[model samples]
Target chain A: EAGVTQSPTHLIKTRGQQATLRCSPISGHTSVYWYQQALGLGLQFLLWYDEGEERNRGNFPPRFSGRQFPNYSSELNVNALELEDSALYLCASSLAAGQGKPLHFGNGTRLTVT
Target chain B: GESVGLHLPTLSVQEGDNSIINCAYSNSASDYFIWYKQESGKGPQFIIDIRSNMDKRQGQRVTVLLNKTVKHLSLQIAATQPGDSAVYFCADYLTGFQKLVFGTGTRLLVSP
Candidate 1:
């Protein structure tokens, strides 16, 4: 089976612009999560969507939002992007939430805000 | 205020040697933990995981030990290889929460 897949491997946007990244979860997975990995920093959880509902979110601002589609694919939209927003945005999928199931992650989309 | 952090920022080891990376978590309520290996420009790959009910779990050439008493977790790789060079992160999952809180990563370097 294919693992999680992300599109637009690399994206470039100017400050104050908007950026959108996409991810498709593995088949049979019901939970999709978005994370941001800044240079020299750890993975920061952004959003969690389960069964098409926003389940949880991290410390990121409202500008960082996303949604999961019925097919379990997800899209992360960063509005008013700042230079600091330049980082690798990763998406992961799990069989379900709260099951302790290991997450399968996508290679990630590197967003560069200039 | 609860967070997961790594004991070290970097670890260097020679090929064929055993390598151990340590992490400490502040949330005692965290019942599940995972170790992830992230290669350069790639997403984190699941190395192994352990639950609160278990003290140790083993995978192919890798072992994860969870000490809930002290809220510590460690990942041990046997006969380390150059391919093992990457950043390793330990994450904790609170029982009711859907997201995983990741720790500051430990960069592992393997030398021949």
Candidate 2:
């Protein structure tokens, strides 16, 4: 089975612009998670969607939002992007929600804010 | 508030040696923990995980140890190699949610 896959391996945007990243979960996975990994920083949880509903989010601002489709694929949107937004946005998938399953991650979309 | 944190910023170990990374969590309610290895410019890869009910879990050349009593977790790599060099993060599963809180991460540098 294919692991989690992310589109736009690399993206570039100017400050104040918007950026969208996509992720496709593995087959049979129902939960998709978004995380941000900044330079010299750890993975920061962004959002969690399962069964087509937003289940949870991290301390990030509302500008960082995303949704999961019926097929379990997910899209992460960053609005009013700042220079600090330049980082690797990772997408992970699990078997289901609230089951403590290990997450399978995508290589990630490297977003560069100019 | 719940937080997972690492005890070291970086660890340097000689090749063929064993490396241990430590993490401490603030939430006793957390029952699941995971270790992730992230290479530069790449996403984190799952190493291994251990639930609160178990003290240890082994996979390949990696092992994860959990001590719920002290809310501590550790990852040990046997016969570490250069390919094992990366930033390792410890994550704790939040109950009732699909979220996992990750620690700051520890940079593992294998010196040949």
Best by TM-score: 1
Instruction: Evaluate model 2 with DockQ and give the value.
Output: 0.52
Per-residue lDDT of B72 in model 2: 92
* Candidate 2 lDDT by residue in tens digits, B53-77: 8999999999999988889999999
Error of 2 at A104 (Å): 0.8
Q: iRMS of candidate 2, one decimal? A: 3.9
Estimate how well candidate 1 is docked, as a DockQ score.
Answer: 0.53
Cα shift from native, residue A41, model 2 (Å): 0.2
Q: How far off is residue A65 in model 1, in Å?
A: 1.2
Instruction: Give one digit per residue, the lDDT tens place, for model 1 in B16-93.
Output: 999999999888889899999999889999989998999999999999999998999999999999999998999998
Candidate 1 lDDT, A43-68, residue by residue in tens: 88899999999999999999999998
Query: What TM-score goes with each of the models?
Result: 0.95, 0.94
**DockQ for all candidate structures vs. native:** 0.53, 0.52
